[model samples]
Structure formats: structure tokens, C-alpha cells
Target: MPVELTIHQPSEIFLNDAAVKVKAESPAGCFTLLPRHIDMATALVPGILSYETPEGREVFVALIGGILVKQGNSVTVATQMAVEGPLGDLKNAVDVMIREEDDRDRKTRAAVARLEADFVRRFMEFRKNA
Candidate 1:
């Protein structure tokens, strides 16, 4: 029996297919899952997830850190984000994802700093009026 692999993002399902075998990376190291693999769950690191389809075609997906669960012949990967394409294209996708995340983080930090400054200013003004 082949394993049913489903990759899900926050907004929608990324990929759903039958895979003969699947490979992913975790904190401990890289691991491969077979159809009959024991049920388990692991925290996946940012890396390439590769799987062999029933027709023997290899597919690649670039994923940020996430959780993977294998129960029976079903494997589910839930991540904040994932990009799927040929193996050669995965690297470029990962690079773009990292840059976008970094930009978002920078903007978030700037917003938080402004909010903190405004709160401090208001507190100081209230103290003077008392």
C-alpha cells in the first residue's frame, strides 16, 4: 500500500498525492518514511521534502519549519508555508521564502518599536499632569 501524503498550509492544501516513499528533515536528522512505517510525529526543520510517486516520478517541496505526522498509510505535513516544484527549482523557492520572511520580521519589529515609544510618551505626559 502506498502512503497518502498531504501537505497543508494555513489557507489551503498545498499537495495531496500517493507516495511510495517520503523523505524529510527533522531536528535529529534526515529521515525516510515507508508505507508500513510505524505511527509517529516529528518536528520538521526547514528543508527539502522529496517523495517518489506511484508512477516513480520524484517530486520536491521546499518547506519551512513544521510538523509531520505518520499514521498508518497516511502522512500529513502541516507547515506555515510550502513551495512545490522540480528539485532544481526548490532552492530558488526557498531563498525567496527566506527573504520574504526576513522582510516581514523587520517590518513587525519596527511597528512594535513605534507602539512602545508611543505608550511611553503617553505615560510620561499623564505623570506630568498629576
Candidate 2:
């Protein structure tokens, strides 16, 4: 499937185009939803949202934000206030995300930490088992 996304930055309102949707994290969990999804919404938190364009996942840190995703055959993400990162650095990218979110509220910070930790734990567990 070839699905392209657009993320319109609030500050960059002059640019009225849907920017590419990157892999991202919500309060519920971390996922990469492509276009043509099932139409689901999630609570946005301060964390990292990554977008993998079939080729690979590009991780980015989202500052003070939330997004809604609905993925099935395809997906789309709508977010706010995001800071980008390198090509392949999910962990480092997420680490920065935790600290940045921590600058906001204890609750938001804690939530981001928990989510990031959960992702790490799961990835580790999967690798160990694999």
C-alpha cells in the first residue's frame, strides 16, 4: 500500500499542505497507522511519534501534543507541536521525548515515561523470546 500523509504545523499555517505522518506515540500506545485505517481516535500525550513509509520508520519527538489514528489497510495521523530527529534513532529520539515532556506536567511526563518504558520492555521481551 502506498499512502502519503500531511502534517500541517500550526505555526506553519502559511503552508497548507498535509505533511508526511511519521511514527508517533499516544497515551494508549505506540503504533504506525497508515492511510485507510479503521478510524480510531486516541488521547495525545507528550512523547515520540514515528512514521515508517513502508521502507522504514522515521521517529520524531512530539512536544505538547496528541493525535488520532485509524488504521486498517491504511492510516492517517493528526498531531500538534513536533520536533524531529535523525533517520534511525527510536530510543535516543524517545529519550529526548521523555525529558521534553517532563518539562510540561508531572502527569504528562509520567505518562510519556511509562509509555516509552512499555515500548522498551515489549521490544526487549520480543527480542529475548525471538
TM-score of each: 0.88, 0.46
For residues 12-116, what per-residue lDDT tens digits would candidate 1 score against the true structure? 999999999999999999999999889999999887999999999999999987999999989999998999888888899888878887898999999999999
Q: Considering summed lDDT, which 10 consecutive residues are worst modelled in model 1? A: 93-102
Highest-scoring model, TM-score: 1
Residue 10, model 1: lDDT of 97
- Per-model CA lDDT versus the true structure: 0.94, 0.56
| Number of the predicted model whose lDDT against the real structure is largest | 1
Model 2: runs farther than 4 Å from truth?
A: 13-22, 57-61, 69-78, 87-130
lDDT of 2 at 127: 100
Tens digits of per-residue lDDT, candidate 2, 45-125, equal 666555555555444544455555455433444555555656456456556766755666788878999999999999999
Question: How well does candidate 1 score on lDDT at residue 58?
Answer: 91
lDDT of 2 at 85: 59
